[model samples]
Target: MQIDLQNSTLSSASLQKSQEARKILESRSGSGHDFLGWLQLPEEQSARVQEYLKIAADLQKLDAVVMVGIGGSYLGFKCLYESLKPAVGTPAGPEILFAGHSLDGDYHRQLLEYLEDRDFGVVVISKSGTTTEPAIAFRLLWSLLEKKHGKDAAKRVCAITDGKKGTLRQSADDLGFHSAIIADDVGGRFSVLSPVGLIPAAIAGIDIYSLLQGAMEMCDHLRNDKSDENPAVQYSAYRNGLYEEGRKIEILVYYQHAFQYLAEWWKQLFGESEGKDGRGIFPASAGFTTDLHSLGQWIQDSERTIFQTILDVEDAKSPVLQNQKNDGDGLNYLAGKTVHDVNRVALQATRQAHADGGVPSLRMKIPTIEEFQMGRLFYFFEYACGVSAYALGVNPFDQPGVEAYKKSMFKMLGKPGHA
Candidate 1:
């Protein structure tokens, strides 16, 4: 992966701040340092990753697997699936479905009804085990599984939760379910390289080893590279510089539709990590060409407070030719072109158009839509997010503001501890 900041307004001072941020992250001397578990995570969990692969291989024989979790628990796995599975032709893993991310009655009812006829397994993830959505969804789903499969249900259930504490851990022990631990030091959003994300990917037939390898390589490179050459440091510097220049919103733009969930994961990573102290670039996303007709106008001509970071795929998975005989659509001057060719031109045009409209932007060029590249992308963004938040002078690992909503939610729902 490569980051191009040709249009970025970052300055020397921004570079210095990024250098300091790097020191802080490398030394684990910054705020939220306790959650730095993700720094060397890929290398640390090598043996456990193999175990997850074995379990995933076993679960692959099932008809479907319902991964139940909300927020960080589910987003990373979903992002990996959305981005990789499409390139893999037929999905090699079980039909992976998600629940507990929402509380919509009809949604869960439909999920229940959908599972009634199919043989499925369950993987419930939560550090606390009592997060409203996942907790409720797990209870309902486990009941259905037990009713359908009887004593065999325990073999099909897996839990990734707090190691020795939490209601989920106790329940896993009581129910004899297979279990993995989410390290106390790893935050959910950053736990993608951990079992929380890897197990689901393995079950779905993603190559966890290659993914981790890519991340490990990137982690090492980013830690040692210079601010001028390191994509992570440059990315952090660019965003922080832009933020200082009155750019309060950063829109992550993608030319590929498959990257939608990737964007969602990114939103959570940067939003949760940096959005505090009345600061942060409000994270937003848009799929291009489609959004070109919808949000295109605003992004092109709206306020200048917005800057864009575009994820550009270097090559297309499959190419379609514009036939020379198709003159009905106007003389086919582009008859020899592939769809990807047209798309590349479209992207260049869009970038130029947006730049002329007063938008400063950066581009992250992905070599291909493969596991290794995806791994690299994940680490790149994560490392940059850490540095960017630090350069902004905020804790990059904690989401203190997130608890406010939970408090109100629990009180409204009449939870026993709310008062």
Candidate 2:
């Protein structure tokens, strides 16, 4: 209910210094880049989105839309779509799907099963066209398409790949599929604004313009309006200060299972941005009350090696429970207690106790974890990550470290998993 940030962990001194960061933010507001890299639109960067929308209209006639990329591929678009659960005009219209991970056969069979009577469209994404999971999955699906729709089946597909040329690009061209190129300079994790993300979002009927507007506004807030009032500087100061205070392991705890995606999104943002050359918070996630079973022991009684950022929602929009009915056992104390209410109270109590004790909890209680909320979270984390990188003198946009595994994986004969 408060427009002001409700639960902040910043001390007075740290909050005060955020004013300097705000000044730096004001200078770069909308004055900086539109899109991140070289695949500029005919006019402005947003013009490309309009073009993608036209393409999406045709592609949406299909029943399901499958994307074939990983990391940023799945995190940004999947997080937004699943969180929003956006309304669609038709169940037969385009919906978001992924097919670029795991070697398991059941899911592959299930995908085929789902497409039994459905006319499917796909967007296969790979900047290099060489990411293993995506490549193998896309190839398998490409074969399926040929079986179903014939050699020109690529007409029903869209390929988001390298700009000038790549294996995917050439394949798409040869097969006559429409194409959207990933920008040269923007890395996959940071390519959400690029066609890498927008194309699938467009297909899914998401208000990507609104999503980008939120990003643009947050960018403006980070650059031109980031006073101590701004969340970006405030969160960064609190988090980095905690790191300086030896709270190195940050467990991002969320209660609602749906909001769990925020954990992965946060991990990639903080982990990729700050974890350079042996530095940064070790980002981890907990679906609270649930993780209280597994991670709670270590957090509560183990070595004092952790802190928490609990992502709480003001309310779960839908909650079902029985009234104060009389049963055999006298359960009066818990009779009227809805699980949602109990969960919130428990989380609040946990926050208070952690703060009262030596361990500090950064309670980022979101107003709601809906589309706009997710949009807000994405912007907040992105700007905060930028500030963290700026503070540490690293480029937030590039991810050389993330690419290291691909290099090593190509050298190996087969999949050697990651935990």
- Which candidate leads the pack in lDDT? 1
Give all TM-scores, in the order shown. 0.97, 0.82
- Residue-wise lDDT of candidate 2 within 183-288, one digit each (tens)? 7655666666667767787788877777666566555555565357566777767777777678788888888877666677778877876777667788988888
lDDT of 2 at 163: 69
Error of 1 at 293 (Å): 0.5
**Model 1 CA deviation exceeding 4 Å by range:** 87-90
lDDT (C-alpha, whole model) for all candidates: 0.89, 0.69
- By TM-score, the best candidate is 1
Clash totals for all candidate models: 0, 3
